[model samples]
Target: MSAEAYSKAYIARCHKTLKEWGAPLDGWFVFNVYDCLEEANELFTCELCGCTQVRIVHVMHNHHYFERISVGCICAGIMEGDILAAKERERLVKNRAKRRKNFLKKTWEETRYGVSLLWYRGKRLRIFRLGNGRFKVCYNNTSTECHKGKPITDFLTAVHAAFDLIDPVVEIWHA
Candidate 1:
């Protein structure tokens, strides 16, 4: 189906769902957006529009409603009444995924002591393996001991986390 037709159908479904749930149709805000690539092989059904295979999930909440809904980008746009902003948000998510892929593909130099290192944005990026089977990422002289509740279990995950840490600085540098 064409984009317009798909969007119209999704919007219609969204409206119907919202009305059924007694939720406001146009005042929902996206609270979070995430890529479900880890579950890519599994089918994801949008709660509002019933669309399947939605890779990027947008969690939306309405001020007047207590329950939140998870939907695809189109349904999110329809609920929020701003397709352009939803598209823009999805674009940034895609770019972040690309950057993470590129980060893993970068030629990281390995030290004789088994440390992985790379130079990014004039800062020395380093990944060190801890004795407890965890990983630590270092930028310049500062090192991150942990990444919130997520444990860095391997070199690749550490590198990805490093990208998450450094990409913000990269954006600031560009700005």
Candidate 2:
């Protein structure tokens, strides 16, 4: 089948699976989408369990009259066995949000004058100043020759490849 068709079918299956489990769908968004018919696939992992066990309890497909519109549901594993209590869940969520905010701020700083994005022989590389006051390579955008309608995946792989070029002493965090 075509890639767009495959994406649609796969999303449908994910919805089905979540429905079968009666999972709560919250804080979900479309990670990315093609112009009309494809989306990058995402799997929700338990932040507490270190990934591997499924904690999804349901799926809610809110329909919108737009092409390529889809939702990615992230199931909070709070309902799982020996899961964190209400207070603990609140603390975890707060901490995660704080980290996410900090990450975004750092990325913005790097994207601004704090970092330099240069193109060398058709490859993009980033030179940034770390919080610790050190100049380093933050990313290298080489080997991103493959391009389909999957802009999300292509963009991510490029960013990651660039991150891989970062200096070992630099600590790069993501949200």
Candidate 3:
């Protein structure tokens, strides 16, 4: 269906269930969206249909009425302008999280804090602390003969920065 048709149907449903702020659908907007696996602690009920355990919750607001409501995807599908965009965003979030978790479990776990060579995947990571107190880092190499380009000082910060190249949100810890 066209956007206008969805908007019209959404407004009609709002008229029955949703409270309009200033001029009904004029100022209605979706603020946030979340795709739950099992279920989030917050048991959100659809303001439009009064359904429970909504898999996807669309946090919406009516600027005219100055009211906020959380509704399920079924209700949001009729009102939300682009459900595809929301789904795309959800996919990206999951992908990033999965990459980060795997990097931590595999790469981070395999990292061996050696006296001279910090090894991961049986290859020495191109990270070395120099005598001048600056740590040298090399980017994209297969062997020990790597470039000394990025310089870092702190150990934890350097570790975080190195893995951030793979996944920015990847966590670093001492233990």
Models 1 onward score TM values of 0.83, 0.22, 0.43
- Candidate 3, residue 144: the lDDT equals 25
Candidate 3 lDDT by residue in tens digits, 73-169? 5455444455565455445545654554454444323235422334454554455666777655443552222223454665544554455543343
Over 4 Å off in model 2, which ranges?
Answer: 1-79, 85-94, 107-175
| lDDT of candidate 1 over 1-175, digit per residue (tens) | 1466455666687788789998898878888777777326454688986777787788888889988999888888888888787777777776777777777788889999878889976878989888999999988666675664588887777877788678752222112
Candidate 2's residue-wise lDDT over 1-175, tens digit each?
A: 1345235455455446545545433323222211111112334443222333222212222233122222211222122211233224334433443443343333322355755565543555665444654344433443222223232233334343344343221211112
Cα RMSD of all models vs. native, in order, equals 3.8, 16.3, 10.8
Where model 1 places Cα greater than 4 Å from the true spot, the runs are 6-10, 38-43, 168-175
Give the alpha-carbon lDDT of every model.
0.76, 0.34, 0.51
Of 1 and 3, the candidate ahead on TM-score is: 1
> Could you say which candidate leads in lDDT?
1
lDDT of 2: 0.34
Clashes per candidate (backbone, < 3 Å) = 0, 5, 3
Q: Which candidate is the best by TM-score?
A: 1
**Predictions ranked by TM-score, top down?**
1, 3, 2
